[model samples]
Target chain A: MSAIAAGVTGNNPALNIGIFAVFVAITLVVVFRASRNTKTAADYYAAGRAFTGPQNGIAISGDYLSAASFLGIAGAIALNGYDGFLYSIGFLVAWLVALLLVAELLRNTGKYTMGDVLAFRMRQRPVRAAAATSTLVVSFFYLLAQMAGAGGLVALLLGITNKTGQAVVIAAVGLIMIVYVLVGGMKGTTWVQIIKAALLITGALAMTIWVLAKFGFNLSSLLGGAVDAGGKTGEALLSPGKQYGATGTSKLDFLSLGLALVLGTAGLPHILMRFYTVPTAKEARRSVVWAIWLIGIFYLFTLVLGYGAGAIVGPEAIRAAPGKANSAAPLLAQALGGPVLLGLIAAVAFATILAVVAGLTITASASFAHDIYANIIKKDKLADKNAEVRVARITAVVIGIVAIVGGIVANGQNVAFLVALAFAVAASANLPTILYSLFWKRFNTSGALWSTYGGLVASIVLIVFSPAVSGKPATASTPSMIQGVDFHWFPLENPGIVSIPLAFFLGWLGTVLSKERRADKYAEMEVRALTGAGAEKATPH
Target chain B: MSTSHDPGTRPDPDEPDWAEVHGSAEFVELRRRLRRFVFPMTAVFLVWYLVYVLLADYAHGFMATKLVGDINVGLVLGLLQFVSTFVITSLYVRYADRKLDPLATSIRERVEGGAAK
Candidate 1:
């Protein structure tokens, strides 16, 4: 390992550079080809609903395994041990909700965007506007996380120091996603998702196998060695150990993270959109079952990678790295496997960033184009198919540019923190509206609008006030009120628990207060939506 | 292109509507039972998840207080979160199969059934 590092670290930056260029070129070719077939609005937004169950299932997993899973979980496992594994476990379990309640039903009802499901029974313009707003916010925050990770990966791989390099990668990715969606539409996006998913899973599995073999196939001893090597802090390198800070912080951190992953997975817009790719509701349900198996297999491998890093690189080395303790996966790939393997892994990591960011950009565009523009702005009265497709393509480009700028500004923050904030917003804004609209017959349009806005505002406000966002030190020496609000009152780093229920409450309250007769409206829409035969009514209200 | 169908073949009623009505009292009772089951089951699972999270956060003394081989109470509680998720999901599936599915089938029958006349 040392010999390979000595040989490659300073002398072969050119090799890594050449390999990275090839990856970008390949991605460019795929996106270009995909755009050729993107001729109509249906092709651009829904891929004409042509995906098979297994193909869409693989795509769903690709969408879920962002930089957060490939990089974040591996790093967490390296630093925090069992807690890291817990994150993957919680993530997989959330699929049960998706499988049983959401995936099939969503495919059966909506043409595009989550808001369509919520707005099917309500006034068109207000519902579309609310849904579009939620989509943009959720996608923007998620995009920021991926772009930040892209910047980090580029800097680490190319040996560049100036932070402007990070912004460059973000812009390049934003451009790729924009062009892909504009030209190739859903077909191109699905193929990219499939390829990227394969690359990520293969890279993770290969690293896990190599790391395990390094310990002579002895699992128990490897864990023991890691714990001992973690030093006299007596922190169990295999266990979660004492709460991270202030004696009780670890427990709160663990619970909040657990809640976010389990509930938040069902709420993600891009993940939800994958369900719309299938031909039927039953196919959508079948696709989710396949996703469960694929995710389960990948997460089991993450555990090995974490343990391997802990055993091989040691916890002290992980802590010493610049930026984060969670970057152990990439560093370990470099340490155990030579630069060739590391290059391969880095390429996979880059592909992951591209695939996930592209999915988010597309979903946001669909929300804006299909739901807000065609439905709300035009009142579902678009006369020309060609014009509608053109509008969607334009929206895709605009969303991509907005995300790139956000990513550049959020350069120095933790990617995981941004991702958690996105989850909080999703659970607050999207999940409540979706769950209520599907199950509750009493839920009115006023209720959906108020709750969505209420949840979106509340989660954002709470997150901005939390200590995680406070840019100041926890100690008194660096304390000052930014604006007039004190940060101490908002203790939890994530606000999902507080914000999600609040959205539900607002929805219920709004419905009760308005007393609008929406049951008949929804009943008709629901029947048609479930049956898929009625020509869509000219946008409701 | 043939551009036509048999003139004597009348349109099947189910072709337009997609389902048949089954409005027997037995079916209505079954629908009510399914809703009753799903509501309570969802309520129980949600409560269980909340209690698990709250106990982990607020009741630290118990978690920090160790058990065997430095395997503290907190680790056990945390792992239980995974267990609870699977348990809830399995219960949901079972409820759907036994109750929700049949009720939904009945509702579809009512909507599609010619007997609605």
Candidate 2:
């Protein structure tokens, strides 16, 4: 075990870089080819609505399953056992919310951005502005977390222990992401996601099979091995409370995190935007079903991979590694197939980060250009049709730079909370507004504005005041993001329990308080959303 | 696409009668069918999930009860969440295909095809 642990830490940098370079080269060619048809705003923003349901579903899985899902959850399970599995369940179950409630309806009504759906019935300008604000905020925080994860991941895989090397790697990732969005637009980015999702799932599946084979294809034996390897806390690892059951407040915190995880995905801008890439509402529904299956299967693989790492590589070795829990999968790869498998899995992890960040950049830039600039600033009267696409490209570049800088500044910090915070903001700010706009006839501009801004502010303020940001001290297993600071008033690390209900209430209150009733517009939106009566047509180039 | 609608006045001749369609028995039935499936399903799953979470958080001994060799209630319940999700998705897909899609398709064609004329 010690020998294998040393071998994992001493991974061959050249082989890892070589595998990753080949992946980048092939994806770049694919992006360039896809860019040839990028002509219209619809093409740039929604991939000309050309992809099939299955294709878009794979891409959605790619976008939805980030390095956090691939690396972080695997690490969490490896260390904390059943507690880590909770995240996987939360994430997978969240897709049910997306499928049952929002997926088809959003596709039937909106064109490119969430703003289009929200502004369909209400005052267009204020609603679009507010939607754009939340979209950018959610995308930016998500981007920061992904970018920072890239640095830490490369540090683990390539043995780049120096800060300068990690920063350069982050900048390079940001540059590649910007190029993917700027050149290929939505079409290019979607293809990258599809490819990456395929690779990630295949890699995980291979490791799962390999690990199971080692234990004679018996899950019980594998579980027993994990329990034996866990030592004194072996029984605790098989159950819950290892991570989230220490105290009453900690139990409440678990509930809060569960709420955020389950409700947040349906409101995510990038995930919402993927629904537009399919032509029909049925196709959108199909894509979501597809995503649920692919995502569900991949998460199952994480279960095996996590425990496989625990049983084979042992927990103590995992903790001693540089990236700690996050290094479990790669170390397992080394233990199973030496440097060659580690290199391949490492490339897949890198591709996961790249695909996710590229997806986010496109969503954020599209929101800015479409909702904020084209609709609000230009008032839907753009003389040049291609100007929106151009603006989106420029916005992508600007966002890439911002993400690179943020990643550098936040590198090596505990940015896991940022992703959770992103989910909180999405659930609180975006979901209620979307639900109201789609379902409620009396939903107006005041309601949209109130829910969006209210939810955004409430979630962010609560996160800032929560223990995640300041009060918590570094423990033996986990380190606080900010040390020696103890000013937190909020008890729970996640604010979803408070913020989501508040946003829903505020939306209702704002509508009743205002005299802005547009029953005719509501009728139009309802007919369109339910029956697909004036939904955007597929303009495949 | 146009947002400027005078509430009391008739819509443009070229535009489909959205208000009329919205009030039609077909549209009303379609919406009812969707709500009937989704709303109840949503409530069921959310409650089911909350129970599982509460068990994991509070019912430590019960969750830790060993079912087999190293298999426990907590792990089984966690995997059941996955099963329930897949089941709900397949059920919704089947329901929509059989009951909802045909009705929605007819209404959409009526509105869009009428607008074209």
Per-candidate TM-score against the hidden true structure: 0.84, 0.98
Tens digit per residue, CA lDDT, model 2, A1-541: 6666566657798999899999999999999999999899999999999999999999999999999999999888889999999999999999998999999999998989999898988888999999999999999999999988887887889888889999999999889999999999999999999999999999999999999999999888898898899999876778999999999999998998999999999999999999999999999999999999999999999999999999998899998888889999999998899899999999999999999999999999999999988888998788886888889999999999999999999999998999999999999999999989988898899999999999999999988888788866788345557879877898888899999999999999999999999999888888888889868778846
Worst window of 10 by summed lDDT in candidate 2 chain A: A471-480
Expressed as tens digits, the lDDT of each residue in A1-541 for candidate 1 is 3433333234355666666568767766876786666665656776766778888888888888887887778777777776576667768777766765566557656766788778877776798799889888988888888876666666666555477866786787678777766667777888788888887888888888887788776666566666776676435444443334334554565576666666777788888888777766656766786777778778777777876777787766665554344457766887877677767776777778878888988888888777777777776667775776777778778878887887777665554567888888888888888888876778888999988999899998987877666644545322332424455557777787688788889989888888776655555444433433332111211
Error of 1 at B53 (Å): 4.6
iRMS, all models:
7.2, 1.5
Q: Which fraction of the native contacts appears in each prediction?
A: 0.08, 0.83
> Which stretches of candidate 1 lie above 4 Å from their native place?
A1-11, A20-36, A216-218, A241-254, A474-488, A525-541, B1-117
The candidates' DockQ values read 0.14, 0.69
- Return the clash pairs for model 2, or none: none
Which candidate tops lDDT?
2
